[model samples]
Target chain A: MDMQSVITAAIEAVAAEQGKTLRPLTDDLVLLESGLDSLCFAILVTRLEDEVGFDPFTLSDDVYFPVTLGDFIRFYDDAARSQAAPTLAA
Target chain B: MQHAAKPLRRWLLEAERGRGRALLAPGTRLTLDALADTTGLGALRGALADRNVLVSTGSQLAAAEALVELDGLARRIVLAPPDLKPTDIPAVMAGAGIDAVLCDGDHPGFGPDVLIAVPGPRVPLPDAAAAEVRDTEWVLLTSGTTGLPKMVAHSRAGLIGAIDPSALAPVWGTFYDIRRYGGLQILLRALIGGGSMVLSQAGEPMADHMARLAAAGVTHLSGTPSHWRRALMTPETASIDPRVVRLSGEIADQAVLDSLRRAFPGVAVGHAYASTEAGVGFEVTDGREGFPAALLDADGAVAMKVEDGSLRIRSTRTASRYVGGTARALADRDGFVDTDDLVERRGDRMHFVGRRSGVINVGGLKVHPEEVEAVINRHAGVRMSLVKAKSNPITGAIVVADVVIERTFPDTDAARAQAGLKAEILDLCRATLPAHKVPVLLRFADALAVTPAGKLARHNA
Candidate 1:
């Protein structure tokens, strides 16, 4: 799956677990505005870690402060691309 | 007859002179003189006087010493424990009127303020002069887990007055241990009692630190229910050999209290109920179910009336005013400050029903989150739980539970395991709690949202 799809799946899994209906979580949608409270946000980070290899808890400082969903996705996409580039070079 | 100077400053000074040892960590020790030279408190006093100084160092020892030094110089110091995001900084600054910000970590580009990038045990520069001010000597921010955090400002005398010498004597001997406010108070008491103080780093590994505390032969240990929960879960916590273990910050439910008593059979288990705005009021150490209520007068309310039901304390330890706000005048009209906590009086003792704010009006009945959270936390699968009101069209407001489950069942299917856990938790709650008190919805996670100080953020949940 593409990075956006992966992110969407992660968000959906958290929403499902929280008994929240999934809305179109755009890159611009603020995590707080996405009907995800603090607990759900923490769950979402955990789910994302399961899907991706790295733990997303470290991104909390960034996510809580200035970063938005779009910012998070871009960061994730960049990291994914960098990881892939090494294999491609090999 | 000339009385001697306060023992707190004297002990610090003696520790500085290398007559006594400074307990940095468990095995790591420093002379008081060395600590004094390293923290640069003398220069800090000269540079940043009455100005609202923010001590943002990551080290607990440095931060604790800075707080003491600032208190000594009569500087209104706001101790911002590490892990505070830059986003939350502005609101704290505005509320407390912080004049300068200091950080031990690499500067995160926090605007134009003089960002002193000094490490611990380094000499403080005298460039920043202390401000001549004295409205609020210390402003502690409430862990804003719900909404915007509130600043609790205490005057120098008021803060010191809040300490009860006898209450702390049972747990800590010549050594002082405290959790949150109690920790600060213990530090103050060490100074007053002519004792040595040990400091714990905020975010270090729990097991490692507790082992250190065990090796240091700590006499006193204090923390909130949540801190104790994490400590109990720690493998090394079994090794701690403190003479006293005290709990505060939140309500001490029976299960957790019982567990603590069982764990530390020889040690005294005590609990105190107080707040940032009200300061310390009621203390219970005899393993009581609840704290004794404040004494009431002939008028059928609290006898020490300052306002409404809020505690009207006349002790010399009361904060002069809310920092950055107007001076606090006792609302003697009722002769008591309404504590906002609903209580049931049993002769001289008072059992807490719930805080007026913490009570949830579910349909016609009222429920307390603490009661529900206690039930949820009792479940073995649940690591921690928080209960709050979510807007509901049918009930107006419904109770919701957010829980963190233990990692033992990590490999189990998330959906199936969560369903089973929820069912089990709901069943337990139904059996013990009132129908309305049971949470309508349950949210599970690997971890709960915690404040920098390791407190569950109820407001955010």
Candidate 2:
């Protein structure tokens, strides 16, 4: 599956686990407002790790600054693409 | 063999030279000199002289040395607990009359007048004559679980004197060589004693902390009961040297102490009774269940007083005031700070009856959640437990326990195990606790919510 499709699936899984439905995780929907507390956000990161093969949660930087779902997805996509570029080049 | 200067800075400098040991926390290991440099005590002297400085930092060493540096500069320092929320910051600032704030990067925003920033390398200010301040000038905030937080003010000399390092000297040789008061106290005492401070950035992983302790050859280690409990449950902790384990924070129960003794065999297990308001009160090295009432005054309170079974303490070591409120007298008419903990004395030892707010009135008989939770926690399958008083029309308030089971149990069959475990816990409570104190309601939760400070959120339980 494409990165966007994987991101959508992960978001849906998180929403399901939280017993709620998301109105499509657009770039404008704030993660905090979407009911992703620190713990849930951690679980989401773990799920994304499984699907995307890379965990983006690093303590040295602020990964939670992106407010909306689209913003988070874009950030993840860029990170995944960059992470994969070296391997593809090899 | 001997150091002449008695200043806190001098003590830390001495420790750095003598120990040559590093205090390790995750990716950081700070030497005494590095810590001293970061505080910039020399420059802070001018900015903080005769001013109240509020320190907000997660690094125990930084917080501890900052206290010492502020003391050296004659600045009144208020050490805030790690779990202090941003919402309560304004009130604490106003209550303590905090003139400035010193924080690390993790700390949030502060007011413009608030001198909020990280401590750079070295003491920047020039040395000047010590600033004058009143005796009863330091303030600490109450945990505020039962009601609104209050400021407990104390005199600098008096507060420092309350530490009673001699009481800790016995077990110090056995545990990690680092001073114990959680991390903050460890750093403060290490700096004061001129001993090396160790840091462990072991997130929630018990194995990581054990590895750090083993790698550092840490002979003195202190932590909250919860931290110790987590360590005990972890398999890796058994293989690590137990001779250096020193437990503090909450009251040490017999089961927990016995468990530690069994695990560490030769290690000395101990306990301490202290609060933000009372500073350090009493120490128990024999692994006693409760603190001795004699350690307290006539009120049967430890470190303070017993107000209708609620512990209260008055000390020169108390905080100046709440951060946002006017300076109110922490002492009663007779001059003692109340700690608000309930207690029952037996001979020389006193047992904590649990917090007054945690007491549940079941059919007119009082029940402490801790008493019930202790029974629940002792269960083989349970990892942690929180017991709270839930309203019941017939009983007024009944004891309800929420338990978090260890992951070793199968997830699919967790409900069945939880039911069996709940029965086992109920049976244990019935055997040990009084009929009224026995928990009537049992809940098996995936996890218990904890505060930033690693304390269970008992208020919401």
What is the clash tally of candidate 1? 37
- Tens digits of per-residue lDDT for model 2, B14-109: 443534444456567666555544455445556666677787777655665566566545455666766566788887787667778876667666
Docking class of 2: incorrect
lDDT tens readout by residue for model 2, A1-90: 877788777767656645565664666778778765543454456556656767554421653456677777777777877776776545
lDDT, candidate 1, at B274: 58
lDDT of 1 by residue, B173-201 (tens): 21122324556676666554434555666
True contacts kept of 1: 0.00
lDDT of 1 by residue, A1-90 (tens): 887888888778657645677557777877667776555554444445546765433433443332567876776776666555666546
Fnat by candidate, in order = 0.00, 0.00
Scored by DockQ, the top model is 1
**Interface RMSD, model 2, angstroms:** 17.9
lDDT of 1: 0.60
Candidate 2 true-interface contact recovery: 0.00
